[model samples]
Target: MNRFAGRVVAITGTGDGQGRVAARRFAAEGALVVGADLDAAAAALTEKLVRDDGREMLSVAGVDLTDEADVVRFVGAAADRHGRIDLLYNNAAAARLGDVTHTSEADFDFTFRGVARIPWLLTKHAVPHLRAGTDPAIVNTASVSGIVGAGMVGNAPLLAAYGAAKAAVIRLSQICAVELAASGIRVNCISPGLIDTPAVAGILGTGVDDRLRGWHEEQTLVGRIGTPDDVVSAAMFLLSSDASYITGHNLVVDGGWVASGGAGRPHRDVVEALEASLAAGLRY
Candidate 1:
């Protein structure tokens, strides 16, 4: 499609999952991609995929996004190489599975440093170069958890921190969208729901794939889970001219899970109980 032809894109957390998928999708569509990640090996893999697919790309040194100097250097090098930055995908994050009471200070700090603070820092450093490019846009990866409370009855602590951090990302993107609108830059966010990614695998423990399959059927109204490609597709649309009028929008791609009115079906016990209550006419 080449929607991104002649464009320069810098994506963080391209090691795997959503970031890697986004890098690949953009590169395939004719964008010059700079893949950055904490895992050098995974970044290289993405770079190779881009090259093998006959796409324009460069594999850069990993940046410790929490480190201010490191982020500056990474963005500076990308801009220096590309002469300008057209797109910035702030897609990196860290996760810890603990409840509020069980989560430690270190866990909270780590999540904020990697997910919250890094995105802000990246935007701050990349804005100058983005301002000089064609159709500049920033796509942040928030989550369904960020939009609403995660239904993690057992893993409350970990989900709490993760959800809170993602909510902050959503709000931050909105503020950036407003502040940067006059500069011809668009800021948007993608809030994914239970996509099949490495991070989700970690959360499911053993038999993760099977668990995910079951979860998809149960939670999503579409009767299936999502893949990284689903998210990448959303990102591509938001970054393209097709979404010129969209900003400060948190698009949820959860297979109708969020829109369902809880009317799919009721369990046998609930149906039987309801029928009995109706038959007895015990209601007030």
Candidate 2:
């Protein structure tokens, strides 16, 4: 699967997790990978891992994706090196979590700005280079939370801002697809559900959330938690020639969790407890 051979791929959030996985996979598949991240050390480590794998990868560290200047620098470096960018992966997001009533103005603004604004900035700057690319494509990472209200453990609606931001991401991808269509550039997104990443595990109070994994597996028809490989595979296909005709699409890579539609949502008691907590003016 050397579909990306000789192609220049610019990806965000390559410091770790899904971004790291995607960077490695792209490098392994013969792409000239250029990556950026907010964590300097972690991004360097990702670069080292790719180089250790005997693949080509160059990474920039401490990149603030929400900043248009930073996004332009990231895109500019790639174009300056390769003369064109063959793919753009808008895969970075760092934001806050809070329910509407308690969420501060600053946190809400930062959350929406981080999750939704960066992708647009990257796409805008990368567009000029992509216009000169070979069968270029872009993949944005949204979440299943964007498709529905992101009620969490105990039915806590603590991620309302993130959900709204991701919903904007989904819409951004669609609009970009239509706007970039004349340039032969395809744009799409993958909305994943309950992926068992390190971030998710930590949120569940451990290095690994076995109980949470089991609960989601039971709910998802696939009987397992989603993995970075699952996302990378779907993303690669969208960027590949196989999906040349596809654009303006949102691929729900949730292992059928969304289709099942809250089949295993928290019990009624939990929802009631949440309602009570809210009524009491409890802060998440």
Candidate 3:
């Protein structure tokens, strides 16, 4: 509703998915948007989306958020272009799936850095400009994985490191909220449940698509999986004045999965046993 008119927003991971949606939505709200992503093509695509809407947006490709230098450059360019920074949306991250027992050192580190360190690095540099901007706020993307284990979300059992890294993000957002309060910058995070995003297209693809999709939909209390727009709406609220009193808070955009205590998920043993019973002679 144009709440962000004239506001400058710097978003990470704008190459696609939630980040791309964020860039376009923020720009649509009249916010001056700048974005970065490791995917040059995807980042350019986000820029084009905003442009196609007849809005201006600057996007930098191949930005390694784990690298302090790249983080600094991205933040600096946003400030230089907009003369201030009103929002920092730390929305980029990726992870490799492997059991904790099988997860290599490189994989763990890669996930940890991508999921957690990017926010820290971006905040480190953007805080200065944000200090001078109007209604400055930082919204980092966390996942329900941070609050729970991989088992709680889905059958993917290799997200130990990703969970650990996102846990750090949860704590980081809390820290920044307190640290940046004196400077008039609000810090918060959004923890999304399993959503329909490109990141998981492979996992939910192929022969297992229908099965896993059904499982996920059942696991959620709302009887459906989440969407990128589901998260974008929550994020928009947190960035808007409606949530001006909120800080150091994590908004979970799951469709009641967390609240349901993952009640919809039945243990494999139970399911198998029940099937055996049905096949044998146990019938209604």
Candidate 4:
């Protein structure tokens, strides 16, 4: 469990959800953690969680990852604090839901920058220090949305831009992996399915229809939605030496959603329609 002992990890979007959980996990595993988020209070809360567990962590609030200068400062601070950067987790994201027809330029831009550009900026700045560190790795957060847009349609029809942005991230990770491998730095990504994080709850909102949740759970082969911990565990593995030979890989941690086709009732409708046609004895 001390695989990350003495390592320095810099992660983004640590205010809540996946980022917060990642910070705590890395810190718990003996890494010196640095986390950044626009939500000052939430970032501070993540720091407190680490401190409460008797771990060392630095939380930077009001960090706009899209800003090159801000990202430079964040990465610079982490390297300066620990004298090297051992791992970088690009866990921050901005999601605006809308299909192409309804998606505005603003929404597409936000989603693209948050999911793709920000990680590139961070990696650009962190590469030098990571190149010098031990067992260095970068883990970016992608989504099943990037691989397939089928499952979330019923609940979030506006995820076209989000899915596209995530797909870009997967490509980015592969590029970085190949480019950095010679320097002993590994780059990879994790694609999570409908994880039940605080962010999800807030997005779904209180009193919102439960059908969305039901649909996701039913489609997943595990028979349930994923959790932040589920994702954090996969991320930790990718960052660990056990995966030393792995790079340029997109690990799907979706509880078999992608693997099993994630078929739900809507898909079954085709079968029902076919059966009804057969009963009419007019099938072509």
Candidate 5:
């Protein structure tokens, strides 16, 4: 659509999944994409794929997003290469599922720092360039876990830190949006639910994909798992002129899972139990 023609986009975790998808999408729409990832080879591959499609892409491999110095350098390089930053997608994150008791200090720090603090670092550096760019906007990748309590599965507390950190990201978006609105910049967050991404599959391990996928699909009102494209589309909307009036909003791209309430047998049981209570006039 060339909606981003002449614009510059800087995205993190571009090695794969939604990060790579977003990089390609923006590039195809005529933006000069700057992609950074910890996995050098994967980042290079993403650059190759986009360039092969005749799109402009600059790939920086092995980025330590949580490091302030590294984030400064990354943002500086993007601005230097393109003379401005139009969109900054804070798409990089690392997660370890464990209850607060079992989750080590290191793991908890890593998850929260990566999910929440990294975006703060990037935005702190990118805002100046964004302030001067055309239609500048920022999209942060939060999760439905942030909105809810990650109570769908038995291991809900296992992701306590991750969910809390993501909730922080949503709050960060709101704060950044209010702070940047005067500067002609918009900040928004997306809370996705059970998207079919490489990271999720990796976390699920072998031989469990089909079963988990099926469960999630049934739980989601859309009756299917979300794709990278679904997220990228929502991201593009916030970054585009169409969402000019939108800011500090958390868009739930969960296929109506959150709106519908719960999932599978547990959700049904909750409803049935509630109905039983109401029908019995047990209100005191």
Candidate 6:
């Protein structure tokens, strides 16, 4: 509690979901939060929510993470206001559900541009400022798909490009951690499973809450899926001094999905149906 007291945090993709929740959690723990996102309106909404809860926050212009100028400006503005940024939550990402062959070049570019490139850019710019701060840390949100194959969901191709990009993020964070250790900047990553977020709704083409509920109960092994708070908790731990010795670590916050190690293995009936479907060429 109050681990982040008097700290300053900058979080990208703070418009909704994990980013928004992270901002609120930091603020509640006495951190001054700067929320940034591509959607200006959504960022404003998040800002209001934090403010409504009597927390300190600042909303900045939405930055295209792929753009160097935008990232520089966002990082500069945050440092100018807060004096220093203690934590950087690189949580913005886009999802594309398709096989490697089926995924388009544009999809790959868009996903990496928003998720990987932006976070890398922000890290580059935020380094000096973070180095000047007290207990500086960076928390990147990767995914379980980055570490393991995503299972089939109604014959849909799992997130191919998205998973690859997130894997890169994990490696990037690890490299940063090793390189920046001398500078007193800790870099860590969190790999989440299925979290109930607006982006999930878009990917699944279903109502957010309904899809989340179903996935929580049936798909995840923990009898429920993750929430933004689950991720925020991991992030907070990395950013806090409690994890001072922890660096270059990838924390998986999935609901026992990755731990189970039985993701790609199908049940007997499911395997029979899949074989039958394949023999019939119905899958193709």
| Candidate 1 steric clashes | 5
Q: Please, what is the whole-model Cα lDDT of each candidate in the order they appear?
A: 0.82, 0.87, 0.87, 0.87, 0.86, 0.82
Tens digit per residue, CA lDDT, model 5, 138-215: 999999889987534443566788989999999999999999989989999999887778888744343756665566
**Which ten contiguous residues of candidate 5 have the minimum total lDDT?**
202-211
In terms of TM-score, how similar is model 3 to the real structure? Answer: 0.90
Going through the candidates in the order shown, the clash numbers are: 5, 0, 0, 1, 1, 0
In candidate 2, list every pair of residues with a backbone clash. none
Candidate 1 vs candidate 4, TM-score winner: 4
lDDT of 2 by residue, 13-82 (tens): 9998899999999999999999999899999999999989998798978889989898889999999999
Deviation (Å) of 246 in candidate 4: 0.5
Q: Which residue pairs collide, candidate 3? A: none
Candidate 4 has its poorest 10 consecutive residues by lDDT at: 198-207
* Candidate number that wins on TM-score, 2 or 6: 2
Model 6 / residue 232 / CA error / Å: 0.8
Which residue segments of model 5 deviate by more than 4 Å? 202-206, 264-284
In angstroms, the error of model 2 at 146 is 0.7
> For candidate 1, lDDT tens digit of each residue in 1-284?
88998889898888899988888889888888887888888888888887788876776656788788988888888898989999998888877756788889998888878778988999999999999899899999888778766543132345767888989999999999999999989999998877878887655443745563564456667766678998889989999999999999989877766665312234578789888998999873
Superior candidate under lDDT, 2 versus 6:
2
Residue 193, candidate 2: Cα error in Å is 0.7
Q: How high is the lDDT of residue 87 in model 4? A: 91
Which candidate would rank higher by TM-score, 2 or 3? 3
Off by over 4 Å in 1: 153-157, 206-212, 261-284
